[model samples]
Target: MRLALVLAGRYPDLRGSQVLVQQLADGIRGRGHAVHLVTYGAVASGRPGPRAGRIVRDLGLVVRLWRTVRREAIDLIHAHNYEAAIASLVVGRATGRPVVYHGHNALAEELPLYFRARRARGLAHRLGRLLDAHVPRRADFCIAVTEELGEILRRRGVAARDLTCIAPAAAPCDAAAHGPRVGSEALVCYAGNLDGYQNLGFLLRSFARVRARVPAARLVLVTHAAPGALRRAVGPGVEIVRAASYDEVRARLDAADVAVSPRAERYGFPMKLLNYMAAGKAIVASAGSAKGLRDGVTGRIVPDGDEVAFAAAVVELLSDAAARARLGTAARHAVEDPRAWDGVLDRIERVYRNVLAARSAASTDPEASAPDGLGVAAE
Candidate 1:
């Protein structure tokens, strides 16, 4: 099938959503399906330009996508995030093609984090809610990245028949060698964007507690984000490292004694968690963000917002070599299924076929095109 994978942001970036989209496109192409990445660029430019520039870029994307669909005879448009999804829906209406909306996170929960002031954040939340209520429902089908997100879409009025939750998958990396390191400094790593939604402030506070007990422990913030203010505030015992590529990011995670995801965003799955598991790193993540982990099995799951417990969990894993080895091994084994990627692709293929079938049926029978009747037909 010919597919156009749409993303508003730059593609091939280290960000979670972009990483997932890149993997999906690669997988689809590997499976002999035609997949075109319709995104801004193949590399990140470090900073978002002016608002006016962003608007012009998006407008350009809509025009480019419309032309690509017509020229390529694309069978489907799979759009990621709100902006791309909205654009795809516009093209879908004009060209009579099905569009799938792949939801990464709830806009209402994530939008407010971009703002600092209380009043501005409140306004952002209101605007996000308005989009959340309208956007996903317009898609021919909605694919949510986590069960939590699927439920959120349902609550926001996306019909259950039109939605499905598929957890993001990762290719397994070579397990990092875990040998005993008594009397050695323990290294903890947090890799991702430095956005406010990442809850880095909480990570810093928790790391401070971790340091109180294990004075030699060091925390590293590995990201492409410029660490100007964050670096100034991190003080001693914390290092902010910039990763030039995803390969370097993985290498840093594999080298670390422990990996962490301090984000409390419950609805969205943290893509780093998949990387941590793939790298066989013992992890400590807040309960809300720990999507696929089992407490004391694959990784240490601490209650959200509890710096004390989060720190203690990291400390325990740091000191216990055997525990770390056992957990890391289990984590690696969890994602080693050679068939995992194939399974994800299979489900997605089914969605595409069904959506196309439903659209065909609707075109032939006008009554089948009713808003409530729009859904991916059963396999």
Candidate 2:
């Protein structure tokens, strides 16, 4: 089958969405299906320069997507995120093809973080909800990154048959292939964006408590922000490192004694958690952020925004080498379980086949009604 993967952001970007798209494209192609990527050439400059700039960019993206679908004779349109989903639906409507909307996060909860002004944020959030409610309904099928998100779609009136929960998969990490690594000081790393929903302020408070207990323990942040900017937000006593390439980030994870994800958001899954588990590092994450993780078996899960418990969990893991080792090993085993990338893509491939079959059957029978949007349970 020929597929067009549409993304609003730049292709081959460093964000989590980019990683998922790349994996899906590669996995689909590995199964002998043709996949073509259609993405904006650059990330949207967040500056509030002119609304006209964004309008023009989005229009161009839609035109390019339409041309690509036609030229490539695409069998299906698989779009990621909100803007890309809208564009895919437009093209699919024009071409009379089935479109699959991959819902990464509920924009209603995420968009407000981008605006600092109170009135602006309110307007943006309202607009986000409108789009969130309207766009997914138009797709032939919807893929939610987490069960929480799938439930949100259901609550918004999307049919149970129209939605599927397919969590993002982490690429396997070979801890031994990189050779013996010199261990650094007892370090805890948080590797992801510093957005408001990430709850980094709570992390800083928790880390401060951990520092009070273990003065020598260090807190390292791996993100795309400038060091000076992060220093201002996090205050002193923590190490701020610029985000590195994926390989370098994995290496850093391998070097750390404990990996931390302090995100408090309930609606979206944290991709960094997968990397920490794959690196065989003991994890301390908030309950909502640690999806698929068992409390005592895989890693330590603490209540969201509970600085006291979060700090205690980190301090405990840092203090006990044997316990950390045990948890790290378990975490690795949990992630490497049969439900990794191959299994994830296998389920997605089934979705493709089902949708195609339904489309074919509908085309052949004029008396038949529209195909039902069936949901595939996550493995």
Candidate 3:
């Protein structure tokens, strides 16, 4: 099948959505399907750029996307996020192609982070909710990164049959191959953006408690954000490192003794958890974000925003080498299981085939006039 993957951001960016888009394109191509990516030419930052600039760029993207669909005779359109989905819906309608919307995160929870002003943020969030409630309904099918997110979609009027929950997966990384250890100090690493939803303040307070118990333990944060910003957030005693590539992040994770994700959000899955699991590192993550993780099996799962418990979990794993090794091994094994990318793609491929089959059938029927609207189809 020929597929067009669409995203409303710069290609090959450091963001998780970019990583997911790249993975999907590669996976689809590896399965012998042709895939073309459509994305904005401009770079996007933590904050949204000028509204006028965004509108112009999006217009250009849609034009390019429509041309690609027509020229390539694309059979399916798979769009990521709201903006891309809107564009795909428009193109799919024009080209008579089915669209699959891949929802990475709940916009209602994420939109506010883009605006600095409280009033603007509130307005953006309200608009986000409206999009969330309406956009997926336009797609032929929807993919949610977590079951919690699938539930949110259902609440927003998306039918269960139209939704598939496929968590993100990470390629396996060998932690032992990355040269000698950087330092003897036991390193606890957090590899992601310092977004407000990440609960870094709680992480800092918890890490401070961990420092009290294990004075030699060090916190290493690997992100694209400025080191000064992280230093200000966590205060003194934390080391910040910026890694440009995934290879660098894996190397740093290889050097670390423990990985932490203190995200307080419940709607979406953290892509970093997959990296941590792939690195075979003992993880200390919040219960809400660590969806598939078992409390004492794959990794330690603490209640959200519980700094003392979160700190204790990290310190305990850091102190016990045997337990850390056991959990880390289990975490790696979990990712290597059938739920990994190979299996994930298997399910996604089925969705694509089903959508294609339904469309083919609908075209042959005299009464059928494009399979419009959103809802689940029988598996």
Candidate 4:
């Protein structure tokens, strides 16, 4: 089937939503379906054509969507994030096509909105929940990344039966990425944006303790701002690296002895664990991180903020080659063998099919449902 996936941003971007858009496109296409991506790009620059190309890409992205939706003859519109979901809502209304909203994270619930008062936090939550409920109603089905998130959608009034799971897709890289044999310097890798709700500072303290025992341990920070904004943690062995491509990241995973995740449980799903698992690396993540992992089979999950336990897990994995190898093997196999990947994609497709079916059913019912004004005007 031909699928038009909507992204919350433009092409040549590095945000989480963009990455998911690229991955979903790759995965669905791998399954023999045609997929096209729509995202924003720079437009209306003060500089001339070539130079101005970098200004306000989001505006150009809307134009791209307008043209592509018509040119590609897309079968299903799949919206990846909030803005793109709004775009899909617009396209679906304009063209009478079925739109599938793939909910990646629960930001409206996890964080505040519109800068409301402290007393309004409860009220803000109610509104966020309401928005979440209304946002995906336009779609035939809502695809959530985790069961926890799926439940959030349901709590906001999404039909439980209407939600599907498409585990985030991660591509594995070559062993050469293992990087120069890793040596006695046990390297720990953390990759993601340092901004927003991610509690990296907590993880740094945890890592310091780990370093005390494992003196040769090194920490590699690959974040959008870490290389510049984040000061080096007070440690001798820690090393901060800038963000790398999929290939370079895989190489780091291939080389590193262990991977760590210290996300606050209340924040959101740590999609990075899936990436580490896909690369066949042993992980030392919080229980929140392990939520998506299979535990003893895939990797160890410690309680959130338990630096001693978190550090111990890292050291244990670092010290035991056989256990690390075993866990790493399990994590890799977890992606493909007897796991729910195929089911995940099937759920995604099911959402599209059901939405189309219901929308078709609706066309005969006389109320061609109007578009919900969820998509925010591009900034």
Candidate 5:
């Protein structure tokens, strides 16, 4: 099958969405399917320019996507994120191709974080709900990243028959990767972007309490994004370091004694949680972001927004080597399935086949194209 993977941001970037798309492309192609990328990187200047600049880039995406569909004869359009999915739907409508929306998170839940003022956030949320209700329903199929997100789509009116939840698989950490080996007695690491949704403010506060109890404890923010104002958010003992590549990210995780994810959003999967597990590092995560972890088995799960409990969990793990070893071993075992990637690809291919078959049947029967009864279940 030939596929066009559409993204609004830069391709091959360190962001989770881009990383997932790149991995899918590599794996799908390895399975003998062709995949092409459609992104604004060709026409846009920065990652995301100002308001006016963003409007222009989005329009450019529509034009470029249409051209790519015709030029490559793409059999399917698999779009990631809101803007790219909208653009793909437009092109798919005109080209008579099937489109699949790969939902990373609920727009209503995430959009409000971009605005600082209460009124602006409320307005953004209303607009996000409108989009959420209207957009995914128009696609041929929808793939949600988490069960929580799938439920959100169902509430937003995406038919159960046309939606499925497929979580992203974590790539194993490379032992040979190069990164800093800090000398802190106990190191706590968080790796990802500095976006508002990361809930770094909560992390900083919790780390401050941890520092009070254990002065030897240090928190490191490892990311590919520029720290900018985030450096000011860091109190003493917390530092942000820029990671150049995934190898460096893995290396940093390897050197850390404890890995942490403070994200409290319940609708999306935190990729870093999987990374920490793959690295065999004892983890402390909020209940919302702890996807595959069991309370005392895989990793420590704390209630969201409880700084004291979060701090205590980190301090406990740092002081108890046996507990850390046991939890870390369990966490590593959870993601050690060698066939996980193949299973993901197989599921995605099934969706592609189902969508294509439904479209074909609709072309002949006319009344068979309704999306209300076309979907595969999340296994």
Candidate 6:
């Protein structure tokens, strides 16, 4: 099958979206499918100027898809997010092709001010609703990342039959030891975007409290958010670093005795939870972060927003080496029971095969002419 992997960012950045896209595209192409990428470099951070702001982002991708689809013989377009979904919807409509929309979040609900669904007003503090309103029910298939998010789509009138819940996969952490040795003080890491919604302040406050009990404790903040603000607010007993190189990230993860994922979002599973688990590090995470773990069996879970519970959980885990090691062992092996990347793409390939076979068998003619600038076959 010929597949076009689409995203709204740069190709090889040190970000999750870019990393996931590059790996997914390579996997699909390696598995005997012709894979091509259609992206808007403007939105990607370090590529060039003029990032794809609200309205023009998806439209830009649509323009790129229009120029590449037929020329590359793209049989399926797997768009990564809403902006990319709009691109797939437009180009597929003009070319009479099918598209699989990867639902990274419940757009109208999670980023409400940003989506067009009229009921989405005040849902989020962003602006993207106008386009969401113009292009509703645009994809042939919608892939939801979590069950909570899937229900949001159904509530909004999306057909349950057209939906598939494919939880995002995390690469194993066995290979996370190729960087500099971590610090000596009991190292704890919280790595992610520096956005305000991340609630780093809460984590920092808890870390300060944890320091009173464990004086040698080191709280590592790996992010691109306001390091200056973080440095000012961190007080003592904290190490604020902007961002680490890819290898450095893994090294830091491996070096840390405990990793924390403090997520405040109600929707979208914490993908970082998987990374911490993969690294085999003891986790003293938010009650929300604990949702990804199996309680004491995997890692410790603390109540959300409760500094006492959060700090105590970290301190208790740090004091008990045997228990922490037990939990870490289980955490590291949690995902091994499931498929890794190669296994994940194998399942995806099956989905693509079935979609193609059904589309082909249903078509009456295989030799139908495609669009003037494109090609199409009626199935």
Q: Provide the TM-score for each candidate, comma-separated.
A: 0.93, 0.91, 0.89, 0.80, 0.94, 0.81
State the C-alpha lDDT per candidate.
0.84, 0.80, 0.81, 0.66, 0.84, 0.67
Off by over 4 Å in 5: 42-50, 172-184, 369-373
Lowest lDDT 10-mer window, candidate 5? Answer: 172-181
Q: Which of the two candidates, 1 or 6, achieves a greater lDDT against the reference?
A: 1
As for TM-score, the candidate ahead, 5 or 6, is: 5
- Candidate 1, residues 147-243, lDDT tens digits: the string is 8888889999998889988887764332333333334359998999887778999999999999999999999889877876677679569989889
- Runs of candidate 6 with Cα error greater than 4 angstroms are 42-57, 112-136, 172-183, 224-232, 337-343, 361-379
Instruction: Supply candidate 1's per-residue lDDT for 80.
Output: 95
The positional error of residue 161 in candidate 5, measured at the CA in angstroms, is: 0.4
lDDT of 4 by residue, 224-249 (tens): 44344346544676767655466566
TM-score between model 4 and native: 0.80
> What does the lDDT read for residue 225 in candidate 2?
43
Descending-lDDT candidate ranking? 5, 1, 3, 2, 6, 4
User: Which candidate should be chosen as best, given lDDT against the real structure?
Assistant: 5
Candidate 2 at residue 8, lDDT? Answer: 80
Off by over 4 Å in 3: 41-53, 115-121, 172-183, 225-231, 366-379
Query: Who is ahead in TM-score, 4 or 6?
Result: 6
Clashes of each: 0, 1, 2, 10, 0, 10
lDDT of 5 by residue, 1-379 (tens): 8899999886557777777888888888888988988887734224221256777777889999999889989899999878999999999999999999999989898888877899989988998899899999899899999999999999999988889999877643221223444455788999998887888999999999999999988888998777877887799888888887887787778888899999999888888887788778899999999998999999999999999999999999999989988998898788877577678888999889889988888999998755533577535
* Candidate 3 TM-score, true structure as reference: 0.89
How well does candidate 1 score on lDDT at residue 117? 87
Instruction: Tell how far residue 80 is off in model 5, in angstroms.
Output: 0.8
Cα deviation of 292 in candidate 5 (Å)? 1.1
Q: Estimate the Cα RMSD of every predicted model relative to the unseen true structure.
A: 3.0, 2.7, 3.1, 6.8, 2.5, 6.2
Instruction: List pairs with backbone clashes in candidate 1.
Output: none
